[model samples]
Target: MIEIQGNIKTVGLTCGYRNMPIVSDLDIVLPHGKVSCILGKSGCGKSTLLRTLLLLERPLAGDIRFGNLSLNKLTAEQLKQLRRQTGVLFQGSALFNSMTLLENAAFPLIERAGLPRGLASELALLKLDVVGLSRYAHYLPSAVSGGMRKRCGIARALALDPPYLFLDEPSAGLDPLTSAEIDDLVLEICDALATTVVVVTHELRSIERIADHLVMLADGGVAAAGPPDQVRRSDIPAVNAFFSPQSNAAPLIDPHHGLASLLLDEE
Candidate 1:
């Protein structure tokens, strides 16, 4: 893993796409070598905030600082150089369907780091082992299950041994067991690589299992920020609603209730 250390700090951040704002006047700190989860309801700008932080999308206002560099002040070449310290796993895994898992994982090292193909493959294989996908290195993404594909995405993200990692909805489409496995893999990555990991997700279970720090957003601003347990216990209505656990109650209506009536709700 790359030897990296730095906290990500935002000052008066306002983020959005085009000219429209999604989140405004936000400030948060992501500690070094920790797993921070960005949590929120749908349409609450969690992903927007992350994209702005990753320098993928420019913020509408405010400044983002990583280590000593101001993201908004960097030149194109400088930004590219700074980006080498980071890796991203997109929501869909985003692997090339035609590339073998090994090739996919090794692409970053070859393209970004200018390593030889053979050496890149060697490094990629080690990353694959880290994510428990070493045996599937030769397979195409299409040939792997969704869970395996996500693991391969993780392997590729670590191929360059980045000190900072960003994952968007890492467990989005998996079953409960598979999602839990992915959560475990995420924890393992943070521990083994000592990477500063930022995960954008709404999966409550995953948050409870893996997050070391939490930033919860409501309507694009911070509703709460703290450790997972503290955020869960917050009296803030939005926080309470989001962290509330599922109940084990059966339906109150008769099993034979008509679909239309159920949909309309009885007066």
Candidate 2:
């Protein structure tokens, strides 16, 4: 079993921009080797929370830790090292228009890791193959469908073999079938590689298929945080509404099992 300290966690965290808080007093735990998704409507701070964890968005208060490395307390060198262990796929897939899929995937190995070009290309092809993009390795991002581009972005993110991967809106512009494919790939990555993944999205179908744990945000804080079933059963109207958008019914809340305690009292 994974130890509590080995998981990525937040302590009384407050995330925001320009001093305006988006989410406050958060104590979230991303269980080691699991897929934990952040779910909410637009402006609910799902992406802000993720970016805070990545240190791209500065936290207004509180602390974040990945294993024993405290985000707020790290030395510059340590922080840099920590960043290397993380990979990210931005909302738009962020691929360079000029680079072929293979070249884009290999860019990190050649530049960030300083690997030789030939070896990097060989390893990149393997990553592309993982995403079923071997046939499109030579295609530019503009030449492929949005789903394919997203897949390539995912491949590039995996090139560094980071233990943690953060994906933002991975199914944003895709059809239902393509969204399902992305969900399948996420599950495959988590199960086969044992990579801890944090996805920020409101795609219900994708979330249902891939999320092992859920953190639902609303009213500038966590509405519910727990296993998918438990969160789905939350009495919080927004949380229930998300899981059952077609109706106005909401499940009963177990006051004995408040969400804050899930992290506050973790062993």
Candidate 3:
């Protein structure tokens, strides 16, 4: 299990080549074995926070630690080992276009684990089966639907069997039905593998479905952090506004009841 404590302790966290500070003085602890969602509007440092945690970007000030290992204390070799314990599913289904689904999934195993091609392919097939994409083994990214491509990305992320999974905007761009399906898949995978998942997304529907814990980001910091119900009841205006359905927001559909309601109405 991953335990983060004593706050993120960031006096200044920046982004980009100019080193512009998007989020500053940020402090939070992401508990282990929980499905935590980082909610924020676009350009509100959500991605920056994720990158900071992964050590992809060096902070201008402060520090990050996981369990007992502080990011500052780890050498290059140690940092690589630490990263191996985490799996990241990037936004836009960032699968390589040239590689088949099987090869895409196997890449991590080969590169990180240094496994032979035969063994890596065997492991990749197992992960593909877990993601319900076994039939798409030979298919390239272009051949599959968007949802399938997302699943393929997930399979590739899981290739190393990381204990923690980070999903960046998992529900972005997908239709509501497909998004809900992805949520269900995330829940299923978490339960089966006992993985801790940290999802960064703005979709309220996705939050309602998959968030075991919630952290709302606004004004360059966390607005609230707790269970979903507790977050809904928060007195903070920012929290309420963040979760409130916007005028153009997609209608909240109960995944289990939607089909039934439609079928019964048609009767």
Model 1 lDDT per residue over 11-92, tens place: 9999998999999999899888899999998789988998898888989999998877787787777677668888888889
lDDT of 2 at 252: 43
Error of 3 at 256 (Å): 46
Runs of candidate 1 exceeding 4 Å displacement? 1-4, 245-267
TM-scores for the candidates: 0.88, 0.89, 0.85
Q: Which should have the higher lDDT, number 1 or number 3? A: 1
Q: Write the per-residue lDDT of candidate 3 for residues 1-267, one digit (tens) a residue.
A: 343222223333443324577777666666666788988878788998888877888876677666667776877776777678788888888899999999999999999989999999999999999888999899999999988899889999888877778899988999999899889988987788777788999998999899998888877777788788998998787776676746344334654574655565443
Candidate 1's TM-score reads: 0.88
In order, what lDDT does every prediction score?
Answer: 0.87, 0.88, 0.80
Candidate with the larger lDDT of 1 and 2: 2
Give the least accurate 10-residue stretch of model 1, judged by summed lDDT: 245-254
| Candidate closer to the true structure by TM-score (higher is better), 1 or 3 | 1
Residue lDDT tens for model 2, 156-213: 9999888888999999989999889888998999898788999999999888899999
Models ranked on TM-score:
2, 1, 3
Error of 1 at 70 (Å): 0.9
Q: Give the lDDT of residue 97 in candidate 1.
A: 96
